[model samples]
Target: MKFYITFFAFILILSILIGCNVDQPTDVSTSSIPIDATSALSGGDTTILSESSHAFSTPAPNLSADALEKHLDGDLEFEAIFVTAPAEVNPGLGPIYNNITCINCHVRDGRGKPPTVDEKFVSMLFRLSLPNGENGETGQSPIPVPPIPVPGFGTQLNNRAIYGTPSEGTVIIEYSEQTLTTADGARIHLRYPDYTLTDTYKPIPENVEVSPRVAPVVFGLGLLEAIPEETILTYADEEDVNGDGISGKPNYVWDVVEKRYKLGRFGWKANQPNLLQQVASAYHDDMGLTTSLFPLENSHGQSQLKQNPTSPEVSDEILDVVTFYVQTLAVPARRDVNDPQVMHGEQLFAQAQCADCHIPTLRTGVLPGVPSVSNQTIHAYTDMLLHDMGPDLADNRPDFRASGSEWRTPPLWGIGLVRTVNGHTNFLHDGRARDLMEAILWHGGEAEKSRQMTLQMTTEERDALIAFLESL
Candidate 1:
């Protein structure tokens, strides 16, 4: 009996020492993945390698039956169109809201576009703020714009409202065209957008600051969530101590669940701490459906509001499912990853210093509730940190610790397929860039070196760089 016990103990020790074999390659040399190629397994085993239009909508291959069921439930709920107040089913749509359902803005779990000149900007909305807020206007020079929830309107402008309440206003977007020449002498036309809120129901302050945020892609988010905070902090150089000219810093946002500040990951400015809070806030600001996180009508203290669906409009169960759906959506696999041109472009990408901020690879830590996202090697290509993007991209809208010129480095995974999935190649925070090349040109501040490097590339090298991005 003693011998048997000792033998079993030895076996356990060996197993612990051996552990599960991990295939997370953390290098960028020849681009040969030892375990699985990024496109073949984008979210590790959770990936759905489909280059079709529905690619972004698929569930990860690694989800368990229970997780998959919840994902399906969330998918239905996400697609459910909401109606105005007094709704018996899926109730409490809006006193004021941006869109009726999550799918309306996201449009196939992908990016949203800025509305055309003739159409009102619905899915894409402007974040409004005043220079140093007070009950009454304060007399100060170069007033600092604090993101106070507006007096009658919230930080976001919801042009659509329910029956009695008037909408904040319709935003008219006009574009001024500018031309740029590539190193290859390729002339590209770029559009600069200007937004004006017309027919204002609630008066907007004269010194208001506007930040436009288009709905971003929702894929491989759960994996992104599972990446340990320590791993992310390793990249944070708030003071640019390394002298890389790219200071990627983490945004510590208030966590509603924990009631404390935590590393911010989701959202355009990395304002929301987690998926639950992001989904819940979207319910309030975008759909005007009060979740437990935000139970007030978005009317900003206006009277004559209609009935709310419930104390919290969406039930906890529904919120959980929706959150799961958004979190577990699979990242589509890379296309043409090994093509010679694509591989060459990848080398150029590193040479250009794009990888300094857009870190190419990361491994997710354990996710307690959803184990499918844990311990997987992913190639999302984002450090999930903030960088000063210069005045060209600045909205002069400060969110928490992020400055007006600072924006989160968006992930490069699945970028090439935006056209195939969302039917447009519009890029950037406001969807102003006409193509991927245009988006690169718009990079300034910390990424100025990389953009300038791209400009210096030979025409063939530029094409190779683009091909590598496309492969991602």
Candidate 2:
């Protein structure tokens, strides 16, 4: 009888152990987690969490520039709006414009590279606004700041212009470096930017907000657009239900056409949902090219340029062609995974927990007619959600529902080729980081662990890891 009791006790103990291994039912509706007072990396066995679920096969490019002509229609519509001379009639062109042509900013439908010399194309954009917070932990309706008359400095600061003046101001970037040693005794480098404005027409106002955003890569945007809205929202864990330190939430934005809110999955703050709107916005804001969708001219509602006669209205046909060209660009394939440094760095990526936010894969949904983007596994290396990067990286600007300190995860697929494709080696939202190492050091919040671990590695190990990131 005693022997039988002992066996029963052993069985009961075994059952408890098994139950502990199984994840507890999580409450995802609330943005709260049970504070176990343990490390964020604790709990859950990552080994059993199948990475296959994220597997998405990407498609090859058609290898035909001819495919683009069908989309562009021999540039008939674009040529109509093109400026022959500085003062020529430019319908749908900006009254509050930034540049002359689409090629002026995007250059090659590739990434934009900031100038290494004191040339003008290096000028980029900076968005300005203030921070906003939900009244309660329940995430209530956002409260806007009190009305201020005149609302000084209330829009994106343009660094370039056309027709007469070469823009009203210039931005100079100066840098200083700092060396940091990690817990494990490895030295890491840091770069800080000193921004100075020259040739300002007006004095700088006090107590204003500002955030800088560099132009991101334009490739494979259509595939991102083709992804089903529901599929993107499936990853939104507003509450940290699984007990991970990460609390990724979706950003919803106002859809002008539908007259309602929709899932946002593009831009630095996940502000724009579809590629069409994103490109249209850039056309209006960057190159001053006006379109049917955003028919209103860009003014602080106070600029003399708003009444400029040279600016012309852009047509629907040109907008459609440009949108088509941007939507069909393909992503480059992954590089050699067999390289020892790459292989080791990939393992270190997970071990250090960078994969939590920089999710390695997302399968493309069915895209009718465009086989190149249809139903393929893609390694875009993004979660399409927003997370607080802490006050250090906060831009203090709100985009739709996304608050300050929140940013969309950028893809790492073609990072290795940034220097080759764009002929420059700069990274991050503001082009603040000079290289991959500096970019890694800029990581905070959820990626803090990975950054810490990376800094802890030996110089050789860190170089191998950077080699792996460069190879991406």
Candidate 3:
């Protein structure tokens, strides 16, 4: 009986040990575990497996035959170049404009860079606005207002024009270099930019607020738009009541089609409401072409303003197709997600609180007319809300609800591929950051904490952080 009892006790102890092991996993390295399947699919069903230069230009693979055909049609229109009026093919280029075609600015559908030495401004443009005299102090108004337009230049400075027309002006950018030493005694050089306007047809006011914009990547936009407004609003804590030192605020802007205020989703400042409005505004403001949404010329109030034509320069059908094209472009799948260094970098990214504003994962709701991007999981890494990025990076030019020091958190989905696609690593609203690390060092305001944490990281930790970002 004594022997039997001993054996039974041993068996009981063995079973309990097994159960405990099952309940509490051993502290194994995360690298040994399989990567989450969702990590690779940055755009859900719309994610494409491509590391090529043309990655940003691919249509969603899951698009139906009919949708694919329309996307192709829009693709042609996107690349179509317009000349001055009275020509048979693609007329109405510009009386005053920046570029001739959409593809020129958004080369290969990737991000644009500041002009290289001796290079003309092909992808960058300057926004012109006057100071708001009585709209109330900046950042204090409950209701946001548009930037006051400059008298002659409207809201944008058009550097090019058709024959016999005077261009608004040209911008010359000069850089002064500064050096920063990291916590590890490694030094990094940062370039501060100074923008000066010259060759003006008329003098702009000394108080004119100038904001330089480099055209951002056009892929994965549909996924961003599909993210539910409620989902985004949930992340906004303008009061920072959570005491996390991050206050993400939404921008409410005028929607021409809806004729009411709506949540601003696109642009460096989150100034445009939807993809349709964004595309239409690009045609109107960037190209000086008109659609039904913005039928007036960009030079409307100036002496160079032309009479309104019977029909819009860009037809409704073309506008719809182009919008659909951008809506269906697939986001490239993330690379090296399972690599150990990448996994560590990802952890560092989270530990440093970079994920607070650049939120890693979001589930997209249905976007009207675009089934491919709707009802899917994505990792675009943006909260789609404006945050005060500190005074150093401030444009000092407000847009709708965005303060001068505030900017929308740009999506980090395909950021790692910008150099491969666009051939330059220039970044930020004005393209001052020469590379990703420089961009991080320039962070301030709401992002100051994250930047501080980054500054304190060991050299290995910083490299890991960058490796993780590159994986995305």
- How many collisions per candidate? 4, 11, 0
The candidate, 1 or 2, that scores higher on lDDT is 1
- Candidate 3 similarity to native, TM-score: 0.92
lDDT of 3 by residue, 131-157 (tens): 785443354455778888899998999
Which digits, one per residue and each the tens of the lDDT, describe model 1 over residues 1-472?
A: 9999999999998886564211121222223343445444567767765789987998776676688788989999999999875667777778788898999889899999998767766568888766554322321112222367666666888888877778888777889999878777878788988877778785777777678999999989999999999999999998899898988877777787798878889999888899999999898888788878877767647542555445888888989999999888888778787789998998998999998888888999998798889999888889999898888898877776777788899999999899899999889999999889899999999999998898888889989999988877
Model 2 misplaced stretches (Cα beyond 4 Å): 1-60, 63-68, 72-93, 113-123, 130-154, 164-174, 183-186, 196-199, 306-312, 368-371
TM-score of each: 0.88, 0.76, 0.92
- What is the Cα-based lDDT of residue 1 in candidate 3? 100
Q: If ranked by TM-score, best first, what sequence of candidates would result?
A: 3, 1, 2
As for candidate 3, its clashing pairs are: none
TM-score of 1: 0.88
User: Model 2: what TM-score?
Assistant: 0.76
The stretch of ten residues in a row with the least summed lDDT in candidate 3 is 24-33
Ranking by lDDT: 3, 1, 2
Best by lDDT: 3
The most accurate candidate by TM-score is 3
